[model samples]
Target chain A: MAIFVNADTKVIVQGLTGGQGKYHGLRNQAYGTQVVGGVTPGKGGTDVEGIPVFNSVAEAVAATGATASFIAVPPKAASAAILEAAAAGIGFIVCITEGIPAQDEAKVYNTLVRDYPNTRLLGPNCPGIISPGKCNIGITAGEIAELPSASGPNVGIVSRSGTLTYQALYELKQRGIGVSTCVGIGGDPVPGTNFIDCLKEFQADPETHAIIMIGEIGGSAEEEAAEFIKANVTKPMSAYIAGVTAPEGKKMGHAGAITSGGKGTAQGKMDALRAAGVKVGLNPTEAGDLMAEIVATLK
Target chain B: MDLFEYQGKQYFARYDIPVSPGDVAYTVDEAVAAAEMAGYPVVVKAQVQVGGRGKAGGIKLADNADEVRLHAGNILGMDIKGHLVKRVWVEHASDISKEYYASYSLDRAAKKHLLMLSAEGGVEIETVAVENPDAIVLLHIDPVDGISLDVARDAAVRAKIDAEAVEGVADMLVKLYRCFTEGDCDLAEINPLILRPDGGVHALDAKVSLDNNAGFRHPEWEAFRATEELDEREQLARTHDLQYIGLDGTVGIIANGAGLAMSTLDVVNQVGGTAANFLDIGGGANADMMAAALGVINFDENVKSIFINIFGGITRGEEVAKGIVEAMGRVELRAPIVIRLDGTNAEQGREILANAGIPESKLTSKPTMLEAARAAVALANGN
Candidate 1:
């Protein structure tokens, strides 16, 4: 019912021996992700928190039939790990590392998009994508996710910023508006899937009645997506773009936040989205409330 | 990591791409000797980190040692695109029959390797593409197969180069790919890839950007790293091993989260203010870290106000508050500081800040980020 991940999805943990990978793998296992196995090369044949460790993703895939891979390797080695997972026929590769050199990711993305046309990549610096109520394949908190059986679905959430996703979800939860699937697409200069890409999937999901998209300054991706929304998106959506008054020329936060000399200004994106019939919020606080109001109004 | 022309040319030479004989000089005397070594009619090129040096007269052809001295003297201290010229590249001037352009860089936004080639070079290729879109050949190289010989040939043909010349251009493109990968360059460009009257492709100018992540593998780059000049705040951030990019705003931001910090900027901007810098103290923004963040922001004269937005998770809010309290003891603040504390031990953190009476009028405990941002913006504007 959800896109990209579900209960049948067996997962492999790349860099499972490392602190972050092991910690998250255990937590992910606790959340019922079916963390089938892991890959740590030298630390193979070992088990971290009861999850079997293997030398390579291929071994993990061959033995456990792990469909998805959660990559927690450092920035420099992230792309190589993604290529390894893709080559091994892992269905979804989620990269959690940040500061990946733009060139390296570009090379990795270009190759993956061309060679493994069917395989999907979630992030290089992104929070791993999740299909709530089915499986948690990424770095999103298990406690935050409300299952479909436990809580009825209302909206599909797609956000570039992970923390904002959590905050907005918390707000939605308080209002008793549970998510069908919440995707933290990761806020990197080059994300695996953009707002438009995620929108199509959310729109097609029958459980998802409305959509909420969180964005940041820099890049015309939002503007481009707004154009698509105007033409295609029938579902009502509420949006928030952070960094409204960021210094004119400074890249103060994320790599993608560099204003690109004002090409993708927050205000400019807000205006476009507004024009496209998306309800623009004052901030994250207003985003969920406004979205809930809009959804109710639509009902 | 953007390499100057001289440094880029060195890498081009490694691939056996033809480049005029050249040497880099840090002084006028050294430049004069390099011109002598290159043989006269030499080009005295200003070694700055920007393009358009030719129009700025940062580049000049010198026929003799006297001319080299004149050009190098004028260029050595000249400023080009905010970069002060401390060195000059003296090289043999070329005899150009035609000018073409080529570049390979990561189109990160698109998540692909972008290949741009143009028949019209010697001028800004961007201008050519903007004006005559058809004149420029844009190619997105498949990350897997890479820039194949056939694809390269196709690009060359699209650039309007003759079929015979496509073979050579294709070969050069392959070599350029090697330089891009092997050199760990984010960008490799040959502007004015000249077609000499003798019928050969010669790279008359080189623009390259070495990936900073790969800096560890290339020790030869250590010497070149010395030439870089960063501002005081950036230098401080480098010392702390923090990722900080300075801005020209008044509201200095210190937040536990990157997304929150960015939203803080948005909040500040929405309320009609500007955030001076983007400073993520990471998850470890304790007192010492707080002190470090304060120290870095305080150094910036542009930072008239400060905003601290923290959403404590595994990171304790009380510990963050203690850090800010301690930091206030060490550094005298010239600008107002706003602290929007939330999450675990948030009330306790607020209590600690309140007890210190660290500008109580300036210290408003905001319930939400939006309110805190509005207050900070108002305070920054002296409302």
Candidate 2:
């Protein structure tokens, strides 16, 4: 009943031999995800965490019928890994590697859009997605998310920042709110998926009663999402825009979270969301509390 | 990393994009020598990363050595919109028959490469987009296909570029696209792509922002890092590989992620305190990372108190607590610290902190971010 991923979504690890890939792959499996197999160049017959390894994504897919892939390769090899996974016909790909060159991402994105229209790329620098009690992909900690409620998960969460994503989920779960699916789209200048993309999916998912979006100061993504929400989304939504007090022009650690030419300020994003009839939280905890209130009212 | 105009020109030259011959000068003598080498009627352009340099008198045309000396002397230390100009680019000024604009940047919303072309050049492109939207031709180039000759030609025509200049402009656009993609630039811009009276098109101004993530591919970028002028605290943080931004507040704030770091600053402000800096130790909050982060904050004189907020997801709070205790032993602090530990293994982390026998006056812990903010703000205000 969760959004992008559920119990039946078979997943493979792209860089299973690497440290991050092996570590998070096991974690995702432990969280109930079907980590059917892995892909590693040259180490075809090996196994990681009882999962069989193949030399290529095609072999892994053929062997395990893996529909989704988690790419944990280094920056230099990430684009190639994504292209290979797409070519192998993976319907969903989550790239967890950070520090990937923008041009490489542009090439990957362009290829996916033009050649592999069915493949959904999640992130180049993100924690990936977690649909509570069903499956977990990428590196979002499985411990923080609430187990699925009897009423089914109600709040669908989307965020640009990883730690803030964890923080919001933790707060909401503590307040007895469960998430249908939480997607971390990453904080790069260009992400494979965006807030609006996730919102559309959340809007259509019957299990998701309310949505909580966490955005940081950067670009026009949040403002654009506000416009989309006004036009399409009818579900109750709450939002939190980080970096309200951040000085303009200075990048607040995230590549995408820079205020350029006095645009993309936190106030501007908050104002846009509010104007679109979305309740904006001043901080992470407040945002979680607001979403909890909405869920309570839904009950 | 934003390249100075002179640096951008050098990068453009590598791609064989025509640029006005130029050399960078740090002093008046160097400026005079550069002017002589480039011939008279040189443009003394202040090398600053910020915009509005021309309006700020950071740029001037020097027809003679004396004028070069005068202009260079004035511009060498000129502060243009908070960015101090440390050097000047002396170049042979081009004769402009017309000015055009071209750039290649990523369109985040579209998740594609964006090409912006405008016949209305030598002005802020934002203003042009707002005022005369049709004057600029915006195209989203497919990354796989890239910018073809026909696409470049169509963009030039749609931008309403001069008929004779369209071919040269189109050629330049193709090269610019290559520079953008191959050069690993987030933004490759030529504000004034000038068409000369002699039927030539050259880049009069260059603005290239290289993606730092692609540093592994380009080893030569170390030279760019060498010339970057960082403040004392910022320089210290850089050496330790800590992501830190020096601010003018009294509460030195340190957190795990960028989002949390920024939110920490906001929360401090909400509790009526100003943050002295924004420091993200990143995912691993080991002893070394914490020590380095603490050392950087300890070096700042404006800091009255330090706030260490950690919400461990992959990073365990027990490890973070141990790191802070060990880091506290490594550095001599001028200010007290308030720590808010939460998430995975947080109780164990708190127990470790409590049993460490650290003085309450120097180190204290709070149960939540809000309470911790209040404690840090109160301590920073000498309460």
Candidate 3:
């Protein structure tokens, strides 16, 4: 069984009255997510597209035993929303907002670990995870996925970026490849799950034969995850490191893309993954084919 | 993201922290008036966001009104770490007997709320740790429990502060913690928490960075944000909702995707020419957006050439070309432009730009980041 969001995952939307919140909530409901309830402070009595609304996450959880929450609230209220979900016993929280202060994120992350030990946090800025042909918990371009192959479903993608995941998946679909699941762990300086955390889940899933890890220009998470893959993961894996040419001492793309001081360069990540015996694709276009070749060889 | 010292002091005062009385002044006469009102021996601090101002001669002690005027005149036009000082902050100078430091911020690497306390704090704490590693004490406060009095006391002892100051420091630390969390601050640093000869602690310096993500809650922060300090080009870009960062290079960049735009910078560096700036118009880059992007780059004196790299997904290539054409019609191009388009409607987009009288070589219809980078660098370097 896939970890995190799957077929049976019941979802609740926080900030459902907002534009983006309503748009994505409706999409998730259409895709068969059991979006049982929503939370909007003043608009508690109203319903969004047939979904019940409540003043708080706890009240919503009490009415409907929602297991997961999709947080679309602004950054300031996001941490409070996560805490609210945690207090309500929602097992999973996926935050889609970006631009959260590093201090607030740290506080939320630490609280999740210490106060709610059993709760799993997906992202504060990520697109969230998608169990293909099932349900999507966060914002990812679902149109990028190709139909299932005649022989077997092959690739699994774990990326630090959300938009890059869509681009990578688009390129993969061009070659008629399908993903078992694509997890966007987010590119914040401190993400809820590290690269290894997602890799561990991917490696354990029997349906995911090969994995493509798409990383950006910053952080030692990819390098550290490579070591774990070598020791623990038995699945064939390939990687594509983005932002290979990022300038020194600049936050080029995402706020998290800046290496702070060259601590997590693309070359550093690529070399580490390669040295760990993982096939590293030079670019996103070649990643799917490289993983396909590796899977073919393994067979 | 960084707030000026005066702004940070204002934030601290709002949180009930004991900050010295200060008034920010933009003119030399205003500085003298503020200093006179603050009384003699006032401190005239240059209003720049970066630290080490005291070392840069930005912070000066004025014994009288004449000294205040002299220091303010010298500081108003001074440059500190790429920021030109346009204002002075006049404050009542305290008699500092002992200096200690306290800060609350998130340690991103450790994924914890960090409290840094040090006894040797008047100088740069980073330097002190590099030279005397034992002078600073760091505490990782658990997010659930937050910073408690016990943790603050332990940090105080580790920082080598006196026993008499421990309880007081602990109390201040607790309030600072509340300020840090409630303020939605990325960092709240009080360097040189002065132990006055009268036996009380005062925050001599305040460095606070609010989280932009939390801005939805703090609407009042908009007034405190000094937009005047931003470069004219950057300010214009912000007005147009573009993400642009100016750099010291000849090749001006305009890219569709943020990831691709960043990779283009790497390729530019690989080919030996520096990137003038980063301009990501997002998926919404159209003819108008392109014009704004070009105008931003053109505003920079260092930009010798323009490079447009777009890998159209949600953004249409032909529309981008039209935007460039439209922008060209309005703002006179100080430098030549190189356009590279790929993905959806890429070939047609190239055709639109080429038909508009731009040279075929300048309007590249390539998909590779390396190819576009090399071409742009060659054109920019005139090689």
At residue A164, what lDDT does model 3 achieve? 63
lDDT computed for candidate 3: 0.79
Calculate DockQ per candidate and list them.
Answer: 0.47, 0.73, 0.35
| Full ranking by TM-score | 2, 1, 3
Candidate achieving the largest lDDT: 2
lDDT of 1 by residue, B1-383 (tens): 66778888987888787799889999989998898888889999988877688889899999998888888999999988888898889999888888888899766556677888888888887788779889888888756567888889888998897655677777888889888877778779998888877777788999987766667667888866766567889889878866677877888888865677787777787789988888887643567777788889989987777888886633467888888888778878767777777654677888888898776654567767777788778877888
Per-prediction tally of clashes: 7, 0, 2
Model 2 docking grade? medium
What DockQ does model 3 achieve? 0.35
lDDT of 3 by residue, A159-239 (tens): 876656665676667767767878888878779877888888888877777788988887678878888987998888888
Worst 10 residues of 1 chain B by lDDT: B309-318
Of candidate 2 chain B, the 10-residue stretch with the lowest lDDT total is B282-291
In order, candidate lDDTs are 0.79, 0.90, 0.79
The alpha-carbon RMSD over the true interface for every model, in angstroms, is 3.0, 1.3, 3.5
Tens digit of per-residue lDDT, candidate 3, span B43-132: 999988777788999989999888988899999999999888988899999998889988987766678788889988888777887898
First chain TM-score, candidate 1: 0.96
How does model 3 score by TM-score? 0.82
Evaluated with DockQ, which candidate comes out highest?
2
